[model samples]
Target chain A: MPALANLTSREELLAEALGEGWRPGPPPGGEAEDAPPDLLPKALPLSQVIRVDYVVPGCPPPAPLIGEFFNAFLSGEMPEPGYVFAKVKALCEECPRTREERVLKKIVRPHELLPAPEVCLLDQGMICLGPVTCGGCSAACPSAGMPCTGCLGPTPKAGDMGLAMISALASLVRAGEEGEETIPKEDEILDALVDPIGTLYKFGVPTSLSPLRERAGVRGSSSPYPVPYQRGRGGEEGGGR
Target chain B: MKKIVIDPITRLEGHGKILLYLDEAGGLKDAVLEIPELRGFERFCQGRRAEEMPQITERICGVCPEAHHLASAKALDECYSAEVPEPARLQRELFYDAYIFSDHLLHLVFLGGPDLLLPQDTPKGQRNVLGVLQAHPELGKQVVKVRARAQRILDLIGGKAIHPVFALPGGVAQPLSQEAREEIRGHAQAMVGLAERMVTFFHEQVLPDPGIQSLLLAEECRLPTHYMGLVDEEGAPNFYHGALRIVSAAGEEIYCGDAREALSLIEEHTEPWTYVKFPYLKEFSWQGFSAGVESGIYRVGPLARINVAERMATPLAQEEFERFFDHFGERPVHATFAYHWARLIEMVQAAEDVARLSEEDALTGREVRGELSSPGEGIGVIEAARGTLFHHYKLSPEGLVEFVNLIVATTHNAAGIGLSVKQMAARVVKEGELDERLLNRVEMAFRAYDPCLACATHFLPGETPLAVEIYDAQGVLKQRIVR
Candidate 1:
């Protein structure tokens, strides 16, 4: 992995981001034609932008975890700044599903399949992000028969969640392909994945490794999303109450 | 002309600003509510799977995510043309009842209750749930216990307390185990007893309060509008699913049918200044916000539900229901403050249903899911914690969402809330005499509706209260009143 320290110069970074010879102040045209009013186009993650002190992971930070945080807070025994007050494990570890068949034969949308009880949703070809998501929610969605949407952000070991998931999915598909006689190649199953970005990078796209992802039939931004950062969780649930 | 802006922008989900235009004499001429509309929700859900909607749409509001989840689930059921099994329906209703009990209790004890429980002179910081708790610690403790119990039941059945993920196209995700069923029964029976205690508190402490009485009888608080809610075949309040019923201001049945026809009956009127759209009956059309037979103005909430339904399904609630109408000595109580009182009445019914549905044999049945046919256009309507919530979707043959439209409880009450604020603003915001108490009176007109727009129910400390800025015609911020 490339060190973030290696990419020090903001000018160089911005130049690379906008174009090879790009400068600040919206080009020679004097005004940015961009539609979305992102406070800072080059906005970094919370840790990157400023000094941070502790985090309780999970979309809303589950009740039990919050209780733990409050206890630690009141006692003045807060852990280090980088310490996230949540289970430091993948969601799949906590998921109560039997994972005997760690293989993806084919991809299926949520409506196309009725997930079997006590079986891993990913094993049933549903694109659950449990393997790549943080475990603080205790596999809440998976237990309920819905695939995990990775709302707790990434787990500690799962660096670059989308890519980590891709690697995991490839190996899972390859394992299935090794036994299937009718299957020509792993490409058949891999190609069947629908709405790739929406499914995989649903939560972390704003601060993603590569935010400006371009594809065929993509919009002007290669994504029409104006959800800069705060509203980045388009499925903005689990806050306020 | 002077303009007064009441900006309640503290809540993160959404912010609303009320612009009160005053004439030279300091008399109110017009009022407009400017709230930021969350755009792109429809577009966001467009290419997503129809089955994924229940999870996605629930994020619209933190306060009533369950409402969105169930409405989306039912809509998906319609899209797939699935006949949800009796077991699943029973489970859904049971879950809904618990939700209603919890949510209504939340509004009663925390949101609207404080306004009446505490004195008007109470400090701005203390005039909320904290003050209510300080006043009645035992009641507060009991309320907290019941709320937690209800939420625990929600977590068990819906899979999580806040944004539930159990509902699917044809039915719920999993069958209720016998253990969970018995657990729900135990919790629900306790809640029923607690609901009755709530009424005892209401009659003992709330009804006789002189300030509350004046607010109830206030001229500005009255609006004779059409009432809408869901009713069972027996014409009783059924929160989960039922035929749509609309009763006129004069206590006559205006329309009774399913959601599709109800959708056709109401038309949305939009304005240039605010994203808040006014939904009114199409029969009378948009007749300029007045409450009469000629205007399309209609309301949906506790007051509307009770007015539209013939009686409460449960006996205890039915008895309270009779006493409620008797106290008013009227059919459709036009007093807007009655919403708070009516909310308590509904809480009784919700608790009763929670206890009753848990005893149903179907609730514990193994067959929680039914078969689905093909994907198509569908509309689902349910009475949310606040009011009638609608979720309409058109799915592609492959089950991807082709179209999406959602009318949450707040949207349905937009026009009524606007008019209520306007009327109150006219009475309260006098020329050269504006105070925080007077502005709060205007806000009282709003909070009574309990329209949890932008998840406005929970207010964290340090967040600004309803701020009023009186501006001259030239748009200079002249006098500011903030709490």
Candidate 2:
């Protein structure tokens, strides 16, 4: 079996299904005028493949976890079927640092400031996805003084990791004494996020609910943001979740 | 004419297939290793921040993520024209050495070792890591322990054993802590001991075995091609930093200079059947891939590195290197199986390098990062565990990546691998009697190169179920084997 057998995108699954004579048509309403035709019959994750016995999560699963999995198999003590994931559901639960809800005056990139060793990176005004990302890596990035970028995909219950991260960030950004008026503008928040899709969906875009477009609805229609994420534009349109 | 397809070649990285064309008499005519996967990585890279390259590119291959990470990071350094600080350079070298030790150990013990250790006629079910473990538990323990120690060293410096987040544009993202340094030193010491044991085991157990020794020097496995690797100013084997060195088939140093010149000296040839483009020296003017000293094809990796280098950097590995030359009786050893021996010697050198670098005071210094400037075009070259890897990038002034051209180690050896498969298939298959053992022998020829097609072909996630089909002269399916 191939190493990445259970980690394919929805489109890849549809292509394979189509090769096996699973014909697919466009979505309802003849599809959006600007959107590509919906070749995917359904948003079926690769994990749902009948032949898939187990899944070892992580952008690249750590060596020790793999060693343990093999050792278990060799010892004839098989893990339960389905997702053989890390014990820690979310990166925040595995992080060694402290976390407390607080307002931020401004967001900062990782290189801008040297973070305190034992403070929550998100609390330090850095855009870290520890709270929304699936853990079991022992908070490797945060422990090394870098912020977690959700490479391990999403928590088990989170429908979309990127959307969860956006909601988390929105709630964390506190308004000044002037109340909601002092809060950072949506554009300002998007600018601070910089490549929000790339950051939040770094490794899980294919598995995320909003693999192509965000749930906020079609862009340039009624949304304040007129354009979608375009490659090589350096986020000039400020389009993100 | 007849065609036999070995689809989804296994026991190696990524997806690939081998096509063997034969005459009506079942005599082999030609063999081609086809890499049918392409993920459009160059397109994906466009519009990404130059700084995110190190992180994004590393995801290309799970087996050699560190190589991609460091190569991408070095490219960023050159793009900004940033001078890496002393401590940062030392840290990068240390991290790279650890990766070399761990990756080489994996190939030697698990991937390639089983073929050399077990009998050639070993049952198909017993020709894998599990079989080796069942046969020799003590050796299995050593393999696990050494790999774990190497992983610890990588985690200590790189932040994670896989997809590490330490490298930055000018330097490493984090400085080494005193405690981490001490831990790494301890692991490095243990690693050196393990490497020495592995070398001794190879000499005593494998070298003396008449069957294995004969197979190592088998004429069917030999391909007299040129060699390419990175060597220091003194012509010593240097994995982290060095100039590109190319040696002709006759062991003459034909080209030695910076990476840019080397890049210009080579051109790529694309075949419609495969996504991988065959790269050959331009001086020969695209004669196409063939067997012989004048094939214009060059191999990279352990055997090529040792063949091209003047000497190993460390004393122990250098001593072993002399013994290797005595056995081969030549400067450029063309025997394909010599790759395993060269890989073992390199593992020893990497272990020694880590021990030496860990004691430096600068390794623990706080000055890890340097300033970055506006982006431009740059090329970064480094000797990955497999061979010399190149990452070329063009970035906009605002630091967004405009273009990317990556020549991974496996891509350099694709032509050589195709030749090897052809040679082995001709020798093993007769009268169209393609059994499990005969088919495995063909796979062994490709596996010896340790080609990571995932990195070479830019493949994406999917199932790779191998299917072998033999077609008769009239294009009628005669036999099919599906796994």
Among these predictions, the greatest DockQ belongs to: 1
- TM-score of the second chain, cand. 1: 0.95
Candidate 1 DockQ score? 0.17
Error of 1 at B321 (Å): 1.3
Residue pairs in collision within model 2: A232-B47
Model 1, range B135-205, lDDT digits (tens) per residue?
99998899999899999899989989888888989898878889999899889988998999988888898
lDDT of 1 by residue, A114-164 (tens): 678888888899899998776777789888778998877765556557887
Off-target runs (Cα >4 Å) in candidate 1 are A1-52, A108-114, A174-185, A211-241, B9-13, B430-432, B455-466, B472-476
- When summed lDDT is taken over every stretch of 10 residues in candidate 1 chain B, the lowest stretch is B455-464
Regions of model 2 farther than 4 Å from truth: A1-44, A48-56, A62-89, A111-113, A156-158, A174-186, A211-241, B291-293, B430-432, B461-467, B480-483
Q: What DockQ does each candidate score versus the true complex, computed on alpha carbons?
A: 0.17, 0.13
Q: What is the lDDT of residue B389 in candidate 2?
A: 88
Worst 10 residues of 2 chain A by lDDT: A229-238
Q: What lDDT is reached at residue A114 by model 2? A: 64
